[model samples]
Target: MAKILKSTDLECFQQQGYVRIPEAFSPVDALAMQDFIWDKLEEKCSILRSEPNTWDKHVTGLNKSAENTIYSDIASQRMCRAIDDLLGEGTWEIPKKWGSFLVSFPQKLNHNWTVPTNHCNGIPWHWDG
Candidate 1:
């Protein structure tokens, strides 16, 4: 059985259209998962390095092979718990398009990176969807 979300959590999600789960997973657990992902990535890199011609069929941007494992055991458990908590039992469904993970490396900016702006057309537009 999962813990029930508080009234405040429901209200916040309704108002903002998204809710942040603070400290949902421990820092230690997160770092361990990250290390696991890096290990898989390194293995893929090594395989590509050893066989140059196989690169065309296997490697993509950042050497990320399409078939490479994305979700770790810990991550899968966390996501399952989150889904159960948010939507109740049997409500979770696999998404048609599972997204890719991105890691942005910091580099010295050549120009002032202005924050992109967009207008929020709130609930009326959202409800119409």
Candidate 2:
């Protein structure tokens, strides 16, 4: 969380249809995630973190780990404010924990199978209210 979201940022998101918030997450906290990922990789396979050459095959699935140890300090208050501005005040709901994670592999799978597509056409869009 840094500066407040100005009208310019909202305008850019409306015109360009996207906004990039650099360094939203803490780099120092995120750096530790490398070790957590490596530890999980080692549990499934014999590939060591030091030996990158051994990590040739890509994993199709992964074991679920506690969000506390895996994704610490990932929430960005700056991002939340920006989203709130776009969606309306108090519209964005901060969850108690991480949810709805769908990690697509580098290899191609199904074409249509994915998260809900929002082309902003006649799609059924509404709030939980």
Candidate 3:
């Protein structure tokens, strides 16, 4: 099979510690993921996707649904191939399901955004750790 990630993608990963693979999954799959997340948000956090005013938090986690197939839907073979390209075939085991994904919601309030000069300054912007 043809490589899903190119040489430049590998180089970028080497230099920047990450890479982007476009269309790794279909739009339908993405929508499904979004719907699942929104449902979780409403169920756990009382945040409704239909109401923009309720988007209070920048990050909300959905951790409990680890065995759902929605994860597998988003984890397309293209994405797996990209991973294999980077890490080598059979080097890593892809989880059947994912636990604890954070959805970064856009704040309804407006504010000036700037790049953080230091680690401590970047507290507002963080990963799903």
| lDDT by candidate, in order shown | 0.52, 0.59, 0.77
Task: Report residue 41 deviation for candidate 1 (angstroms).
Answer: 6.1
Off by over 4 Å in 1: 2-4, 22-29, 40-79, 93-100, 118-129
Error of 3 at 80 (Å): 1.2
What lDDT, from 0 to 1, does candidate 1 have?
0.52
Where's the lowest-lDDT run of ten residues in candidate 2?
A: 99-108
Q: Per-residue alpha-carbon lDDT of model 3 for 66-106, expressed as tens digits?
A: 57778887567988888899889889988766565667766
RMSD values for the candidates in order, in angstroms, are 8.8, 7.4, 3.4
Residue pairs that clash (backbone atoms under 3 angstroms), model 1:
none
TM-score of every candidate relative to the true structure: 0.48, 0.52, 0.77
In candidate 1, residue 35 scores what lDDT?
68
Clashes of each: 0, 0, 0
- lDDT, candidate 2, equals 0.59
Show where candidate 2 strays beyond 4 Å. Answer: 1-19, 99-129
**After superposition, which runs of candidate 3 have C-alpha atoms over 4 Å from their true positions?**
108-114, 120-129
Q: Write the per-residue lDDT of candidate 1 for residues 10-45, one digit (tens) a residue.
A: 677778766666555577766765765455545654
Lowest summed lDDT across 10 adjacent residues in model 1 is found at: 120-129
lDDT per residue for candidate 2 within 1-129, as digits (tens), equals 434557787788777776666665667655776566667667766657787665765753353554554553545676566666677767768655653223232444566565555646858443221
